[model samples]
Target: MTDTVLASWRDGTAKTAILDFVTRATRQGPDFVPAGDRIATFDNDGTLWVEQPLPPQFDFVFRHWAEEVKADPSLAGRQPYKALIEKDPSFLHGVATQDPQVIESLLKAFARSWAGSTPAEFDAQVREWLATVKQPKLGVLYQDLVYQPMLELFDLLKANGFRVFVCSGGGRDFMRVFAEETWGINKENIIGSAAEYTYTDGGMVRGEQLLGTLDLGPGKPEHIFARTGRLPVFAGGNADVDIEMLSAARFALLINHDDAEREFAYTAAAEASLAKAGELGWTVVSMKDDWSTLYRNREQ
Candidate 1:
């Protein structure tokens, strides 16, 4: 293994854990996992990118919601729309985060926005948003704010014969739009919350409908099992919602967001999971201690 494998990662417990995992999981090691069984799953939001202040997808939803209220004056009386109109930060924050009802409402909005459209149409909407939208806090495109060290980890793991899968609580279709370009993982490998789609015009057009699964908490492992037919050898997540998924893996990682200057300082969302990591001997990657850099400039 060369130094460049994880150059962006600081020399610490997090980096050592990764190096040791790769070494032990490689062919020469006595504990080597078979290539076929070398499966790794990762949570998307806070684990892969900046989910502070708000989850990135919420930015997309907020805009869509605004347009909805504008087109229909009565929508202004609704809970989400009223909160948005009143600029209630706490209310917006809940909608942007792990709140179950808010998550469901956002999914309904997503369905309404994309239903009766082709896959191409949905992708185009996400593409346009990625191109046009910027994070309110950082003033950078959300796609461009992906953690650089994690991207390096992906390349390293793949080179070592590990098949990676993203098992995220974020909208499946929403993550699929940027997963390939950002993570270098194929869309089929992504396991996220999804809505049912109805075929139309001989399958050329599809309409999004009711959610198939929410993909949070215990649903993480359930969805992963239902989709992959195997439990992952490795898993990474950042919040309590991922506790079940992390617990189900042979090697688990909890990405602790504690870098106040470079990024966010957040442990409240994953406090229970953090305790679990300690009790179960799962590795917790510290954003402040493990990463030397949060993100890098993307090539246009």
Candidate 2:
């Protein structure tokens, strides 16, 4: 199993550090983590998979909103929802400061548009989109663009007795869809931004009911606490939004995307986050300098 897993690494620090961490964490024996405490949390989007063009959940919500506005033209004139439909990134930029009412309204609108759909149905939709959706610049299927080293790291951690959970800003439902299809991760262990839903006599009804809070920035740590009840010993992510959650872990890693030739070469955000994380004593993994294989695909 080690040899088989090492074959995927191709001599990268991502693999090396992951293997070392797993061995060290597990070697402390069953006493340290125990059976139920072997928890490892990961950020989705930029951490586990490619979030370049746009986050998958964002695309889904946007597409859904576009269809709804197309059907009811009046919705196109609304404030937040209207801005979302118009592709105004600024609408969601400083979302932390937006009125709770505004956030609630937008979330409900999104839920109503996407609710009543079964989990299986939602999964199918995402899979279908991934099959056809191509990144604007890469021109490759979005699913094909996931980070290879990160995937290997996930497997390595799992093999060493860590129960991996995706603690992301993406919708929990959408993360479940991709996790099941791509990595075979259990749906129950996935935690992310979620809206309210109800199973009534009629059917499953999704409402604008805000479940808890958006899982990003400082909210990442909040979600981790709410969902896991205990701090994760190991955590991995790639952005400033993940710093809070990463800081909560005993072993924290930031996937620094600095290699433009193989993958993307943008690190301003990552570097800023790493500086803060360094102050907090977190390990920074440079994709360019540390990972020999940045992406799963070799040809593209």
Candidate 3:
């Protein structure tokens, strides 16, 4: 109920529901959840940051593919590389909608591109990308586009008894590179589609294979349980791929991006999630109405 926490959230049902849930979960009552069992998970893309124009990880990968195509023009004949050369939107549209088939193709190429590279090398490249690249439309770093309200929610949850984790369909190690600094959570708390590794030359190198299922739809809950050993008691997401993770939670928060003035507004991929939220009575926070502020700097 205090403005110090969730300050970006305007006084409304969405904020009230969050606070009330925390109160009930933390208090010694019938609804009280034990500290160890109070796990919260969130989807990273549209839920935590601006995901419109496609997710940021794709931007990073697309740049690499473009360079590869330039070096070997024949590579442009392939599907994904061809997609890049022709400026095709089908593959990217599928990716934006969390199409598993498209993502598998993307990740397989991702693995092949950087196979045998050390984790340190991959991490350094990701760090440099984050540091140097500015989001095209917003004209600011991707890290700066993260929702201020969500960060405040993280602080509130941690202050209570909850341990939070980010579960996404993006590359696991990629998100882990900046998870701690950007989200203020441990790098180990990021769960997503991951590349396997092989120990060679006295160091671990990325293997040319995706480690497990693509982390989307049902895969979201699967990865969360695989890592944390339990389903989330609290969850938040903005897209359809997050359905299973949100469904597994006792408290589900869905973000509705209905503000075009401050942020893009459309539900091309999230239509089902929006319908499901209404059918299930899930809390849907409107970016237009629910947030007093969108970004930390408030200049964009």
Which is the better candidate, 2 or 3, if ranked by lDDT? 3
Question: Model 3 residue 202 lDDT?
Answer: 91
Name the top TM-score candidate.
3
lDDT of 3 at 161: 73
Instruction: Candidate 2: list runs displaced more than 4 Å.
Output: 1-16, 29-32, 84-89, 92-108, 268-272, 297-300
TM-score of 3: 0.97
lDDT of 2 by residue, 219-248 (tens): 777887787787788898888778788888
Residue-level lDDT of model 3, residues 150-269, one tens digit each, is 999999999997999999999999999988888999988999988899888799999999988899899999999999999999999998889899999999999999999988998887
Return the TM-score for each candidate structure. 0.93, 0.85, 0.97
Which residue pairs show backbone clashes in model 1?
A: none
Q: What are the RMSD figures for all models against the true structure?
A: 2.2, 3.5, 1.1
Give lDDT: candidate 3, residue 282: 95
Over 4 Å off, model 3? none
- Please provide, for model 1 over 91-164, each residue's C-alpha lDDT reduced to its tens digit, 9 standing for 90 to 100: 76665458766777767767766667778877897889999998877788888889998888889889999999
lDDT of 3 at 139: 86
